[model samples]
Target: MKKLLSILTLSLFVFTSCNDVIDIEQPGTLLAENAFKTVEDLQLGVSGIYNRLDNTTQIRFNSVYTDELAIGDDSGGQNVTQYSLFLTPTSGMAATLWNGSYITLNQINKILVAAESIPVATGEQADYNNAIAELKAIRAYIHFMLTTYFTTDYTDDSALGVIALSTIPGLNEDLPRNTNGEVFAMIDADLTAAAAGLSNQSSRTFISRDFITALRARMAAYRGQYTAADGYAATLMANYSIANQTQFFNMWSDTDDTEIIFELERNVGDTYDRQATGGGGWAGSLFAFVNSTASGSPFMEMSRSLYNQLDAVAGDVRLARYIDPSSTISATPTTSTDDYLVTRKYPGHQSQPLMNDIKLFRTAEMLFIRAEAAADANNLGGAATYIKQLRDARFGAAQPLPTYASQQEAFAAILAERRLELAFEGHRWVDIKRLGARANVSIDRDPIDCTVFNACSLSNSDHRFTMPIPLGAIDVDAALVQNPGY
Candidate 1:
């Protein structure tokens, strides 16, 4: 997935030529059927799948749609209303999640098809199998993302989840929604197979057994499968240690590659058809105010509550690494009556100096997942121990360990820590959805943020918790149904 250093041109060409199974543009040079003829070709197809993920843009929106972001002064209201908790069925936001995810899934499916049929030499068998396992894991991941955003309730098996497409779509076929249970089962199976088959113990840029386990942990935690999540998360966390303060900042700077389980690598050579919203040179326009050609930046800012928490503990390393230290924001808009603090998370690369690598999974997330599951299982003290390791790294040894006195207290502390640690990385909404549902919690945004956007609070039972499928998807797929209260 090294867009700059590897066969990124081939990856991009494959992506554009085969984005949608139904509406694919004919490749002037290469054909989809012919694209994955050899094992090497199928491997390139996997890289192309990464290109689609790079441009999904869902991660940026995930922060915006929840309490993680505030409107910037230099903003358009393109998705501001959705962030205000007034979701629209026909909104472009819904389409972004739906369309972007499916397109990625379809690209993965193409790889799967090619991998299965491609003839391999005897020496390439193991490598080929591992590649196929990686594809399955990626396919599982895309489906998990869809169900997380589209399905109403994670625990409701009967709830309508996304279509479970295992093969390339035919023009005449119309797939129906599967139950949440069904979709999750597929994800679990894929990861299980992937973990058993994948042998790549190194390379954070590619899918490995660690990614499958980490994803399983997230999946289990979201679905309230505490025992299962705790087991999977424990295995991974035991293997990967959290980055220390110095190492942590370096990781964000793209200078160090410790603790990152899987990340999208965007080095200086990533100029051809780069997938971020910011277009080519930059990581996505997610954090830029006026960097190069991208414009999405200066549009969103860090939530005030998040800034306060990060700034609460003196000399916290996360403060500078996560937030723009210069405090440079183009505007902070009328409703959001605070200075715009851009996320320094995507500050920029060294050579390009404006783009940031899109980190997908990190070791710290595994620890948090383990802690969350332990708490869910009523092992509060165990949970505290698990969370404190990361907390100590962030807050330094001087800070006292806050006792997880009661289940509520443990829940509150753990979730609060998650909010801070995972800020702008896009875990805010799903964390609230599943955890809020479990605790019957409601979000009360800081009044300064709430009063401006008119979305100060979102209850556990709010219908906005579940989003509608994209209107465009429904228009074509007769078998698909909209989520309730959409």
Candidate 2:
């Protein structure tokens, strides 16, 4: 995927021209003739869409709104309001995700339309089909993410999901929210087309059939389709191995790809290589003002609760990989100013500070999904086996197998494992939203970290679990419905 960056200039030109035409001129006429002329142009359009797939917005919101992080010493009142659980239609994360997703979706639609007009020449149909498949895969992923954050109930197909934008709409088109079933049907169709059309790709950074499989696994898990989720996850697990301790340590620095199934590549001089003061940039910049060390101007540190959990796992590689060694350890951290658990999870790569690739799907997550599925099926022993397998890999030895007394206990154990493995990677809030209630868990912040505002715990039943439709979108279309309790 390094070639993705080499063609950035051309992709940008094509993307910008298409966007300008869509905004000002009518649809389906001059833009296709101007922007996309050949198979090469469509491929560049795919690159342009890939450039917009970012996870920083979700990472920032998940960490700040949940118990994964605490305000650092270098904080200048950044994200304090959000950390205190004040979410609304005007929230920055909601607006960023909503607007960014739609903008990229619009790009995908434009490229798909343009691809229809370009006639495939001899031996170029593969490239043409691949480019289209990549766009659909990306489109499916973006729609899935929107539903993940916005849908009121993942288990209820009849529930309202985000508006399903399959094609470019008129300028004044104010589409109503679609049901979860409708949006999911669109996602399935796109993924089916993508999986059939895409060639087998081994690069972890690019979209491939494996990427579709992983997304399907995650989506199925979110929807509580345990059997389907297990099958999808098992297929991926059989193909990709969990990273060993050494590989796991190297993974944070972008030196290892043993477990990564899909990740967005962030190279030097790319669009997200800079300090993302707004929303879409290096993920590490979400926690720190500078880098991932104590010397770096960190504005947020690992939460004491999360740190304690990692520390408790004796000889666990995750503890060493996640916490910076330069952190100042306090015997009793009773206040916000006491202990600082600096995070090293994104310790730069390629001479870039605080910049690393955003990993979307990993084999370790597949293991967790399998564990959850096992627990959901009342297979407590199977759930424990999966947990022990993951723990044994992280610890670099055969550890004692965990035992579960009941299905609830097994689910709780799986949730705990997910927290340790996927910390600071943008899964905490959604994890809590989807599984906390069943496990009898919630966002439990450290008392010291919550001393400022006492916003320590949030139940999964809270309406804030579902993000409100952004105020920017609702401001124009007053008829658009917002999430409950907004």
Candidate 3:
């Protein structure tokens, strides 16, 4: 583990030193090929992949383009394209997610190519296999992300997905879109390989076998393969323990928390200044304005309806932990209420206040995925059981078990719970998309709060809900078609 940390520490220097020159398309593949001739080189490639896990573009895009948050009055007119749903093919966030994820993929491919014929030490063969599996899993994860944002339908096998390639293509190559299911198939194959080689190791930052399981559970749920998702999530629940109520809040502040499956670690002395102004760790910076007064405001605020759920969750531990609940901003919305409540959910920082170790997967999310899957499979009791377990952990043991007379009610309850549980962590927008694709649920934005931001309510079928393929990608590859209503 210390070796992994040291490798990351050194590679971060490489990332920062060439910060100005790391073009998303080229991504310095030449450097990777030149560097990776030995086992240590492979280790550095692993570190490189981990270091780029948390990106500012995807984080901001996912957070701002959700129903859980409304644009803050003091947003300084920044990121209005996402907030107002005026995203185009040329949007910055779209370009970032497109280029950034693919860059990581290219780096991973370089490592795999380098290791193909390299001699492995006799006893270290297992380690080499595991490292390769980890890279494949990471590759699958990146592909899934692109599909999640680019594809219109999560369950539609024939739906257009991003440019899917196992190996790095030529710089001038024009790649066509892969079907959503085709992309998922690739992800599944990688995860299957990863699971075999990972050996169920427990590491919060690295891609352990259990982390692959968690990813499978999430992917299954996203794909509406509820039965399979339930099984995968059950395995994880049996293998790993959830953080207790007393430890839940503290978990966000430290990297050693047990609930984390995989996270992007941020160290104070790392080569990159993640805590500095305009740094990569802006997840907390988006909504966390803890020390601000009435005049100084947050970048985003919680939607009023979401806060109402938080308000009614009956002794919600997250209220004080995640939401301030009481704050006055001198703006259109005088006091923070349903429309403008600030969130501290993604304040998963350590070492420094501003730099947060970005959480990629957590046990709590898997449990929720399990509950939703159960509900989808018409196992309401099973759904309620997981939901009750999570609520008890969040709101306290005394909180009454919820009763649902119908599957629709159960679904609604689970959706509401997800909103409260996963707000500002980048799940709200996709949840809305999945629910919309599966059950035709519309996203009703706050009319009052979003009015000034030029934002309006979005229907389940709104074309803007799914991100448009970035124009930069199409400019390079004209075969790539733009999403509807872009």
Highest lDDT: give the candidate number. 2
Displacement of the residue 57 alpha carbon in candidate 3, Å? 3.4
Better of 1 and 2 by TM-score: 2
Clashes of 1: 4
Give the per-residue lDDT of model 1 (tens digit) for 219-307.
Answer: 88888788888888788767777888888888877888778878877766544334355233354355455542224346666777677
Off by over 4 Å in 2: 1-30
Query: For model 2, how does the per-residue alpha-carbon lDDT over 379-485 read when each residue is reduced to its tens digit?
Result: 89899999989888999999898999988788888888898999989899999889988898889999988878879999989999999999888876644689999
TM-score of each: 0.86, 0.94, 0.87
What local lDDT does model 2 show for residue 280?
Answer: 76
Give, for candidate 2, the lowest lDDT window spanning 10 residues: 1-10
Pairs that collide in candidate 1 are: 73-331, 73-333, 278-285, 283-355
